[model samples]
Target: MHEQDFEVDYLIMGAGACGMAFADSLVTNSKSTLAIVDRQHRPGGHWNSAYPFVRLHQPSAFYGVNSRALGSTLATRQG
Candidate 1:
């Protein structure tokens, strides 16, 4: 891999749901700069592979970072 110097207060890998949320909290709560790198063409991890109208098996509040709310627009997994 090529070597490069990254200057930032925080460096996060993977723009997966958790990573994105953590980065958001850091940026929102502090004056620090951040850099995010992900191999996926898009963010959201496996959610990208899932169809819409799908809700998390568990409560949305239980999924994301504690610093933020994932919203209460909960969906049922049962048909």
Candidate 2:
């Protein structure tokens, strides 16, 4: 696709956690617009395609957008 088709102050290539985190920081720090595109059908890169039986080895609180925690709390384990 042409660059003009999708114009933004920044063009983030991936929509993974890192990419989203960076975008969030940029958005929070400035007014610049951004566009993120990923090959996957949805966001959350690896997490999205992970096996259904698999769970995050680390707590979800540390694995999402910087502005918000993913799960209730890392210290707490729920069945």
RMSD of every candidate to native, in Å, equals 6.4, 5.0
- Candidate 2: deviation at residue 33, Å? 0.3
Cα TM-score per model: 0.58, 0.66
* TM-score: model 1 vs. ground truth: 0.58
lDDT, candidate 2, equals 0.77
Worst 10 residues of 1 by lDDT: 70-79
Query: lDDT of all the models against the reference?
Result: 0.74, 0.77
How many steric overlaps are in each model, in order?
0, 0
Best by TM-score: 2
- Residue pairs clashing in model 2 are none
For model 1 the local lDDT of residue 3 reads 100
Model 2: residues >4 Å from true position, as ranges? 1-4, 54-57, 69-79
- Model 1, 1-79: lDDT tens digits are 9999879988899888778888988887898999998887877777767744554566666665645555487433544
What lDDT score goes with residue 36 in model 1? 90
